[model samples]
Target chain A: MRIFDPHIHMTSRTTDDYEAMHAAGVRAVVEPAFWLGQPRTSPETFYDYFDSLLGWEPYRAAQFGIQHFCTIALNPKEANDPRCLPVLDELPRYLAKDRVVAVGEIGYDSMTKEEDEVLARQLQLAVEHGLPALVHTPHRDKAAGTRRTLDVVRESGIAPELVVLDHLNELTVGMVLDSGCWAGFSVYPKTKMSEDRMVRILREHGLDRVMVNSAADWGSSDPLKTRKTGLAMLADGFTADDVDRVLWRNPVAFYDQSGRLDLDDTDGEPKPDDTSSFEGNSIRRGGE
Target chain B: MPNSGTAPHPSLPLTPEARAWLDTALTEIATAPTTIRTLFPAVRRHCGRAPLPDGRTVDEAVRALLLAALPLRDQALTDEVGALHRYGDPAEQRAVLRALPRLDPEGTGRFLDLVRQTLRGNDNTLIEAALGPYAAAHLPADEYRQAVLKCVFCEIPLARVAGLDDRADAELARMLGDFASERTAAGRPVPEDIAPFLHPFTTSGTTTSGTTIHGTE
Candidate 1:
């Protein structure tokens, strides 16, 4: 079955991950610009990162037959820093880039006033650009963050359907779903929801606008977390159709809203003699 | 010592100042040998090869190399200093500082200064650089073996070399062959983790059944 991981950090993953995901039938991925594990010090760094997302990463993904897409935003954690203003000013240029599916990985981290202001401005930009926003719910004080996120999206006058409240657990899923915005569950290792819990939520929520992602990045997280979640759903007797809708259809529908979800026709069926190396143009020396 | 651009001879006694600088430079070189080695090729590539003034030994060449390489290294280090400050560990910062000579002071001090400033305020990048050696030094034998195995399977660059022992590669090949045989017998989707490493001979075509045949020896 074809699958689409709505959230993943292909930059932090190895080429082996791309091949594995392809082997497991993942046809596409949406990578939202989030803070690298280390804080970035300048707008230049952010611009370079955005360039890689649009340029080099897509080329790398193509080597493994996976379509790569991205979302642009000033992540909440970085918004707290004063030096990040220039980055915020530069967000519009990236928003205009091709294959930017949403303005996101944006939302409250501490529910601070700084976060609120930045989120408000970005939500406005999303409205002006006529694009959807991928909202990242705060890891701490999540209920308050979710509540404030929904409030801002409504106050900003963007359609609720245009927002995706990501990383929802049982505690906050109800408010997100009840408010009519899409709920995203990040099936991660240790910190986020596990596969079993994700399936439980899927069973209860019935997979309307719900989606699952690995949200893997430069940390102790698994890139294959979404596949494990899919396997869990299958083990629980969720039909292939139910699995396909959540893992594939919902993400495609969300990203396609920006009008850039076309996969190369060569990708639909496997091509013979596609023996390309996974390292596409990087000069990193192989280890001894 | 008047007009000699050559480094002090290893056999000849060094002045106290030169001795102190050499000691400090050697310490830094020992800790990050690979980084030093990697830089040597770049420096030589850029600076061109020339024999040292008469009577300089290999040890002196190393010291001279560090002196000549310091400027370029310093520039690269400065560019990454902010990233290091944001992400590096404290011990790594201290080690880097210790390795550099004081470039402002005469002799050893000048070299130390250059090294210090090059690495100064860049602890996070240093820590990441130091991790390979640190992991190689600290990881238990079995864990290191497993990490190397995973790195080989995933194509990640690791400190330890794989395929060093002919027997080891052969044993791994046999185990992989057996696993492929089992998958063929059972008709299961090949595990995603191992699928990348399976050569075309083991898994030839796009068809599900075809994957098993390519992995088989």
Candidate 2:
């Protein structure tokens, strides 16, 4: 099945993972700005990371024939740290970059008052920037957190359809779906939701506006979960068309709202130019 | 010849012939925007690949093209360096660190941040660059000493540090001596690189230049 993983941290992944992803029919992916495994002490570090996401990552993705996009945001957990708050000022410039399809991975981590304030502002930025929201719901007390996330998104007046509430499960999926936003499930080897459990959710939810992703990162995540979920769904009698709708079409429909989402294979024409460079430098080395 | 152990690449200007070639090449790269991976080999084809004594490898010369862009004092040139660093691979990053000499071929300031960045990373190539001559002469004494300790911590051979001879001081000797005692106290043998730092008076090089470790243990 052709797939668009709406939320996967490809920067944390390896080049080998990219090759394997292309092989597994992952034609495109959206890498969101989130907390690295370690805390950053300075806002300059965040900008440097944002620059890489905007500049380096896209170049890396293209080598493997996969289209890479990113959501720029001050992740929920980092919003709590005062040191990182200056990044909010740096957002607008990055949001203007060509491949930045969405302002995302923004939402409540602990539902702190600080997180609430940041969320409200970023949602407004999403509306201002004309980008979709990739909202990350907290792992702890997820049901209440998802509800709180929905309430805040509603408060911003950005429209529910423009927001994607990720890391949803049985208890919280219905509430997010009820709000008319895209419901994103992060299928994992464990924790979030397994492929079998995801198949069950697709069966219950009917795949109308639901999307699945690996949400893969430096943590205990799986990059191939979308491919795995498709196979699992096939085993459970879900047709290829159904897999296409959930993994490919839904994410495309949601993110394409930004109008910046472009896949190389969308036109079925492969980009053969290796000499192409981003900014001023190319990946070209001295010898063949 | 200026000893690299004394004069870092940043202090050394690219030869006039090299400067002209790099100027045209960088204009093509900066204006056209090519990948370092593609530009790296392509530039070498245009400019013959002769390794420098400081051992400027093919990748080093390609990275130097970006550094060359920085000293031109043009906004477009600065952006090119930023793009190259942003998009360049780790080998390219080490080249940036190697290019950190602040000799001001075009009056741009030193690349202390780049040196600090390389020192912060655990990558040996980066560490080697961070501890090279530019870092030796310009890096603050405390940070310089810390970088040496970091080398010991990361198991990088201290011999690779460029200015070990001219910069090695009594303080560094005490630190290495203390480190040796601690190792002896724990029944662990002191690392071989510690010998020169412990006895800098008799050692081959100072923190400034011309240091080489003949034998270790």
Candidate 3:
């Protein structure tokens, strides 16, 4: 009954959500860095977001016995802005850190030349680092973005298997799977893809290396969309194993390849060691 | 003074006025029903109207009443108004505290103490302390770098700060512009050393080695 959500923004969620997810058997999650509803102006702002993903979030998740991981990438929507580069320069240090499983959620939005250039550079970076890349296909003219994304990955000479094309609808699914890449479906509320549609896709596609996510962020999205989708799959007569593969196994297999996924459980509370006297000061006195 | 290793636990309970204020609000909301009806609006609202869990005692109703009212006073309500937000119902909140059992027990010992420490404070120190070390040990290095950058730009202390406020947004935008200018002059990348912290929407180029990529279907 365990689950692994490949995409979720835990920072936007509450502790109750952690507890609920744990109760529902979500053992781990991968939170990709994304644009907050508002734009970030400086590299420092991006820095703080990354810190929370790695810092406060994991700690919070641990309290509920869930493992937290993240993907680091510059989003394509903001790539056209020349101001976003300083933050981009600071990415390598984070990539080297343990627990960064993928470089993703990157791809075109408006299909502008700037987005194309940014995608190319990021693809090259992924190749240089030998990391897998997560591609976010544009909402408008998705077929074009998906095609262009596949072409760019091929043109860059990076292995097709190293790319994850996200937010696929019926129109672009064939091209993505045909391109020999992983296809991700974000089960959203009244927007991207519905749970029923997701189930239909799973039924037709047979769940071979395919995955589904809530992709819940700071928007009108459902955090329990994955669970709902799982329920739909069950109702649609999909076996528990099929449900498990899409919900848990595939994500774990994909992330484990990065060697960053860890799922050790710990006693949730802090138990800092006490010192009577050390370093020329008595640490215990501060509490008094 | 207590020993440095053991601070004296505060023994004060809720003040009569404070308890009375809370009780009064709870009663008003409970009687009117619709007034605080939006608080939890879903399960909690109905629970408030249903007979107590014990079937006869008013305490269950009272507890539900309090659960619905306390969050409003604290200004921490979310989602459905009548229901508790992501923190959980009052009983669940108590259960979480009991299970984890903060070492600094006196932190929430009194109503005024809780208010000063959590509700009225500049930050939630307890949650921050709880998260600090674990996050330091587990979060990937890139994410950590981004957090440091956020702390510097927003001028907030690392401990207990959630994020930049709207007021800081404009300043962050201007600072980013300046940062881009500096990078262009240096003929370097935009994020330079901080590239790993950028989100998928913000950065250009692929990730470093050892990461996996998944496509959307």
Candidate 4:
């Protein structure tokens, strides 16, 4: 099963995660610009982070055979920070770049007035840039947050089809799907929806505009949750075609709205003889 | 071929339009440090994507222009150049590396860290940029030899490395010999690019003092 994990934080991940993800058939990923655990003191740091998403991170992923693309935004959690507000101004140039696919991870953390302004502005930027927006519903009060998120997305005047309301559950899924927006599920080992639940959601919703990702990051999460979800669907008697559509094609169709998703042939194995290093560091150890 | 280092900013072989755009950009960047942030990426979009006479992109040429046009020197030059590199993406970083030979013509080691950083990374383009005239002149003998061997390992053409013919020493040759033997033992053919470096040649008695690699060589 060729999988395209629509959301995964590879920056926080090790090379082993990439290897295992590849072994599990994950060929591509979209790393949204989310807040790190430590709060950033300034906007310049976000540029460096954005630059890595555009430059070093993609290069690193290529070494492991995954094509990496990213969404650029002042994440919901950071929107409340005054120092990070300037990132919105620089979004235009970053949005113009080839690899940037969407204005993302943009929505309410606490559903603050500050988050409201940032989300509206970024959603407008997405519309102006003719790109999609990855709207993250607040983990706390998700049903209400998803409702507010849908309201904000509607008011921004962006086509609902171009918006993906992510980190969803049964409570929020109905509203997102009813609103004509894409519904994104982050299948996790704990806390978020599990593989069995995801299989049940698919069983209920029938996978029209659904995308399942591990949303793996620095937290205790499995990058192979998408694959696990696929297995659950198969065990529940879904066809191979059904699994492929949910795992691969759904993401391709959603992000393809950006007109920037490039799924070129990626060489997924580490070449045995290749001794190239990044920033002077190599994946090689004593004798390979 | 002897290690004849690159001539500093040999008259750019640019079309009238490209030269005009570069001149305007240099003026803007000189007046405001902030201008480079936008103009640096705009170089390819404005100056055209065609390869320059030195095999650098038009964007790389602007890097040399910025380094040359700025009035800062010594520690100021070092700090400005370092910041320019620190904030840049790989292509921009590659541009800075390509421009370094001309910016610090004397192998004063001001930019040695930048070159070494590129050499450490696995990006073949950045590695190739690291092997430019600046690195060729500044990289220590031991590290230089390892970088060339790394080029062989990564399949980056040995020809991309500057000053190889002049800098190729007995140690590098021995390392390549062992590498070739290993490939043979593994039933793999050796890389063809190493042939020119492996052949025996006497170095001129005059030591190569300069740090630069002329693309023409």
RMSD of each: 19.4, 12.2, 25.2, 7.3
TM-score of each: 0.55, 0.58, 0.54, 0.73
Output the lDDT of residue A171, model 1. Answer: 88
Docking quality (DockQ) for each candidate: 0.01, 0.02, 0.01, 0.16
Best by DockQ: 4
Candidate 4: segments with Cα more than 4 A from true spot: A266-281, A284-288, B1-88, B91-122, B133-159, B168-206, B209-217
Best by lDDT: 4
Model 3 spans > 4 angstroms off = A265-288, B1-217
Candidate 2 ranges beyond 4 A from true positions:
A266-274, A277-288, B1-217
Better of 3 and 4 by lDDT: 4
In CAPRI terms, where does candidate 4 land?
A: incorrect
CAPRI docking class of candidate 2? incorrect
Expressed as tens digits, the lDDT of each residue in B1-217 for candidate 4 is: 1112233334666667777777676666566655666566556545554566656665566566766666566787788778767766676678788878667766577988998877776667678878877777767778888999998887777877898877887667778988999999999879888987664634444334444532221
Model 3 per-residue lDDT tens digits across residues B74-171: 22332222132112322222222222212122332222222122221111223232223222322243443344444333222433323222111222
- Candidate 2, number of clashes: 28
lDDT of 1 by residue, B142-161 (tens): 34344444443334343223
Minimum summed lDDT over a 10-residue window in model 1 chain A is located at A272-281
- Residues A1-288, candidate 2: write the lDDT tens digits: 798989999889987787788888888889999999899878989887986776567666765667888999999899999999999986876676556789988999999999999999999999998899999999999999999889988889998889889999999999988898988999998798999999998888888889899999998987899999999999999999998998899999998988767554443532421223222122222111
Q: Put the candidates in TM-score order, highest first.
A: 4, 2, 1, 3
Show the lowest summed lDDT stretch of 10 residues, model 2 chain A.
A279-288
